[model samples]
Target: MDKLGIYAVPAIIAAIVVFGAVKRIDLFEAFREGAKEGISSLISIAPSLIGLVIAVNMLSASGFFDIAAALLSPVCNAIGFPAELLPLGLIRPVSGSGSFAVLSSVLEKYGPDSIIGKTASVMAGSTETTFYAVAVYYGSVGIRKTRWTIPCALAADLTGMLFAVWTVRLFS
Candidate 1:
């Protein structure tokens, strides 16, 4: 005969619920209170989320991203990455989802085997979501210290980009 204790989990939960109700602790009330607290936090963070969306949209529309890519193209080509992935390097520092979309477009256009597409895929894996960092650091402390952040984050993004292209080209 095979022993079965598989039903014990639900039995234990039932016992706990019974004990709590008998003790006069209202479980539904407690759950509602916790959910209300979570909603309050979401409301508090709403402004920051909206600001992030607007800023990312503006950056994309400005054409500054393309200018950045063009400016960095020479250095990118020198570092063994295809010049086309320069926009990906620019995008990665500004927005994660945006960069992912750009990477997908590149892959679809060129196919993943092409140097540009492969380099972009590698860079996407290697880099951090830089705009999220700024939003978090600024939004948490209310710093608004936008001066030094962009340069520092861009430097880190560039380093990751170079490393990604180099490593991918070397190994693959």
Candidate 2:
């Protein structure tokens, strides 16, 4: 089974090459065209993505999230939310990488089997990077006025993070 996994990708690639040859399609040209389209899409989305990433990094570096987490910790803890997991929950919607860094820190400090770590992991898996997705997909298509999309997506992300805490507590 382990060997099967190793060979699967090569087998798939070989099959594709043979199929392309049989159909007399120019595989190299097809690959180049696909790459071109991908690059064009990247170019369209890059500016918004870069700005989002920079903003996230700036907020993180300025300790804004840390302060926010500290301020919200009491409210969170009263409702059975782990005070330590507040940062991960707060950042998960805005930036995937930022939330991942928070998750990693949680795992390191609390260990993976600990309730805080488990909740962080679950939240990371359950929530989407709402701002990142809005910036990428919406910006790619040139949609500037995301009136309701941001609000709705953020609400969904908050729901997911809350459920992650509840589910982990329930199962653990």
Candidate 3:
């Protein structure tokens, strides 16, 4: 059953493609149109994504992120998360790629089997990409008031980090 689950979506897609081809329904043209639309949408959102990347990089390089992690360290320690993961928690809510890079660095520095690595991995799984969320929501609605979203998302990420650490400790 699990194996079938892996193949199910592809199987359905393959069935549709075969059927469409056999029925002479211009399937290739339809797919090309869909691809073109996807490209256009991606292009439309390119500026927002670039701004997100630049803002994240500036925050990280300006030492604000380190300061934030330091400020949160005590509370994080109280919640069972290592002080080291505090920075990752801060970044996770703001940038998925940045968070992933932090997670990878943590894993490299403190092997995957280590408590910190496991907790970070679990946190990654439990947390949502917050900045991406804001970008999509605001971009869709044309709302520019992003001031509140970051704090709200960071709170959620912190909760997820605490939960992940606690749960991992229990099961490991």
TM-score each candidate: 0.52, 0.60, 0.55
Residue-wise lDDT of candidate 1 within 81-132, one digit each (tens)?
A: 6666766777677776667667766686679878667778879988888888
TM-score ranking of the models: 2, 3, 1
**Each model's lDDT:** 0.74, 0.80, 0.78
Cα lDDT of model 3 by residue, 1-172, tens digit? 3366479989999999999989999998999999999999878766766666566567666877568768878886786567777767777777766676677666876798798888888888788888788899899999998877778877877778888877778876
Clashes of 3: 0
Clashing pairs in 3: none
Question: How many clashes in candidate 2?
Answer: 0
Local error of candidate 3 at residue 127 (angstroms)? 1.0
Which runs of model 1 end up more than 4 angstroms from their true locations?
1-80, 146-150
lDDT of 1: 0.74
User: Candidate 3 — worst ten consecutive residues by lDDT sum?
Assistant: 48-57
| Native-referenced Cα lDDT, model 3 | 0.78
Model 1 scores worst on lDDT over the 10 consecutive residues at 1-10
Stretches off by above 4 angstroms in model 3 are 1-75, 145-152
Which has the greatest lDDT? 2
